[model samples]
Target: MQTPATPKFTTREFRDVLGNFATGIAVVTSRDTEGRPVGCTINSFASVSLDPPLVSFCIDRQAGTFAAFQSHGHFALHFLAEHQEEVSRRFAKAGEDKFGAVEPVAGIGNVPLLSDCLAHLECSVYQRIDAGDHVLILGRVEAFSSRKDLPPLLYFRGRYARVASE
Candidate 1:
């Protein structure tokens, strides 16, 4: 069957529309073969399934961490706490020492898990697919932990926000 044509929007318009959806921020981190830490700030992480314990996140096609994440075989996803905006900014910067300003612990096969996140997941890459300008990486969850007292950092409308309790 032929695909139906969808209305197209400018990149800025598209971003604005997508920004309306609130998402939790996370840093997806892995080490290169040389053991150098590589990571990127990601807002596209989500639970894919529970039966087999799978999760997924999107990495931009041009991100510096893409190759390392693909070749490293394993990685850790640290869910940012509301107070960790600096950590997110550090990871998002290009050509900067992301780990220098933060503390990380090697866990689950040497993947670096940032200290004091709201939660973290250590995973092994299970599958990958190219989609538009990003690659969707599916990981099989190997380990995970959460802190009950922490609130998550949220991204919405191109800004950071906290989820307020009613």
Candidate 2:
């Protein structure tokens, strides 16, 4: 199939288009070279493959903790619940102590896992794909658990939103 010509659009326009779709928020955690904790909030988490039990999340190559995530073979994906907006905001900030106050416990492969999240996914890096300005990290899921009772935190159209239960 022939590819369509690139459309004329600005970065904001592109972001606006993508932002129309709602996605769950997650905090991806890993350790630095010295075993120091590192992480950031991301909305790009998704299931990649079921047969191999793989999941993927995209991280900006220019993010401060991208190097730490790239260096480590394992990391944890914590799905933020509706009540954990503070956790999302905390991790999203640059130059701030994302884990300064909260102490996380080690999960599979010594990766840090946050508490009270809707779910936790412990994974080892399965593959790394460079996609434009972001790095797609495909992880081989070693273990995962979720709280079925909580509503997940979501992002849509440049702001936070929720699913209203009927």
Say which candidate scores most in TM-score: 2
RMSD of each: 1.6, 2.1
> Can you write out model 2's per-residue Cα lDDT over 1-166, one digit (the tens) per residue?
9998887998899999999999999999999999989999999999989999999999999999989988999999999999999999999999898898898988998988999999999999999999999999999999999999999999999999887987
- CA lDDT, candidate 1, residue 45: 96
lDDT of 2: 0.94
Task: Output candidate 2 Cα RMSD.
Answer: 2.1
Q: Each candidate's TM vs. the true structure? A: 0.94, 0.95
lDDT of 2 at 118: 97
C-alpha positional error of residue 40 in candidate 1 after TM-score superposition, expressed in Å = 0.9
Per-candidate Cα lDDT values, in order, are 0.91, 0.94
**Tens-digit per-residue lDDT, 1-166, candidate 1:** 9898785878899899999999999999999889988888999999999989999999987887878977888989999999999999989898888888666888887988888899999999999898889989999999999999988999999999998897
